[model samples]
Target: MLEILTGAGLTTSAGLNAFIPMFALGLLDRFTNLVNLPEAWAWFSSDVSLWVVGVLLVLEVVADKIPGVDAMNDAVQTVVRPAAGGITFASGIGTETTTVRDPDALFAGGAWVPIAIGAAIALVVHLAKAGTRVGANTVTVGTAAPVLSTAEDVSAAALTLTALFLPVLVAVLVVAVVVGLWLLARRFRARRTRGRAAAAPGGSEWTA
Candidate 1:
């Protein structure tokens, strides 16, 4: 139960920023005895993976702050984020069991369940993120995107780190963030529609 919650939290975090969970895991594994990777997953602890993920993390942060670039980046990550979520979920489960250590279990039947759940969660979050970002760009004219990106990065980092110790809280926070963003996006779209309607031919327009 705890493992599942932790995995879900990690998956949620990955959906927001795919590299954050991986980087957090790698950092914990390298600096402390907090996390132990399976034998097959030992590469996550290697300096090379650390450096690569770290660099990508930096790139993602910068890209997410730019208006047009962030949208393109999100589109490109449509495939990548789900995969990262699946991996993070699997790793979370793997941390709790010795089954992951067996090469044969990598492709075993039951292993796919968590992966699928993670992917689904990630896809949902990704879609929501894309919608919200598009709405934000339209409403704010890209002026607030950098601020939004910064908040998202901080949230991702907080969720990733919190998943290590307080997964239930992370889950609550993720739900809150997603729901709040969805509501705000919906409101923006509604306003946009009304504005367009008012500007249409034969529609009322105030001169004052």
Candidate 2:
């Protein structure tokens, strides 16, 4: 139960920022006693891996803050985020985190199941976020790009930490992410529809 929550939280955070969960998990597993990664996954906490993840995270952060570059970044992240989410989710489930007692029995039938489920979860959240971002960019003329990116970074970091140490709170954060993204997407869609309707001839929305 707690293992699933941790994985879900990590995967969800990956949807927002691909490297945060990885970086956090790696650091904790390497430096602290909070996370004991399985032998197969121990490489995540290596110094070299941390450096690579950090560099990618920096690049992702900078690119996602720009206007047009953000869109392009999202396009690229459409793939990277899902992959990262899968890895984080699987690692979260397989690792012995502070909250994850007896992580081995959490999931059966090999690692593919958790990986696939995590990928799907991340993909859905990513879609919602991407949709909301597009709408936000359109409505604000890209002025809100930096703000949105910063908010996502904060949320990702919070979720990663909570999922690792205080998994009981992960459900609340995941729900908030889902609801926030859904609301933003709907609001943007409504605004875009209104804009389209107003622009059509005779205020008609029948344009093909």
**Best candidate, lDDT-wise?**
2
Give one digit per residue, the lDDT tens place, for model 1 in 11-116.
8888888999989888877787767765656788799999999999999999999999999999998998999899888777566322222222343468788788
- Relative to the true structure, how large is the alpha-carbon lDDT of every model? 0.79, 0.89
lDDT string for model 2 (96-171, tens) is 8777778856567676988898899889888888888999999889998999899999999999999888889999
| Regions of candidate 1 where Cα sits further than 4 Å from its true position | 96-109, 204-208
TM-score: model 2 vs. ground truth: 0.92
Q: Which pairs of residues collide in model 1? A: none
Identify the candidate with maximal TM-score: 2
What residue runs in model 2 are displaced by over 4 Å at the alpha carbon? 202-208
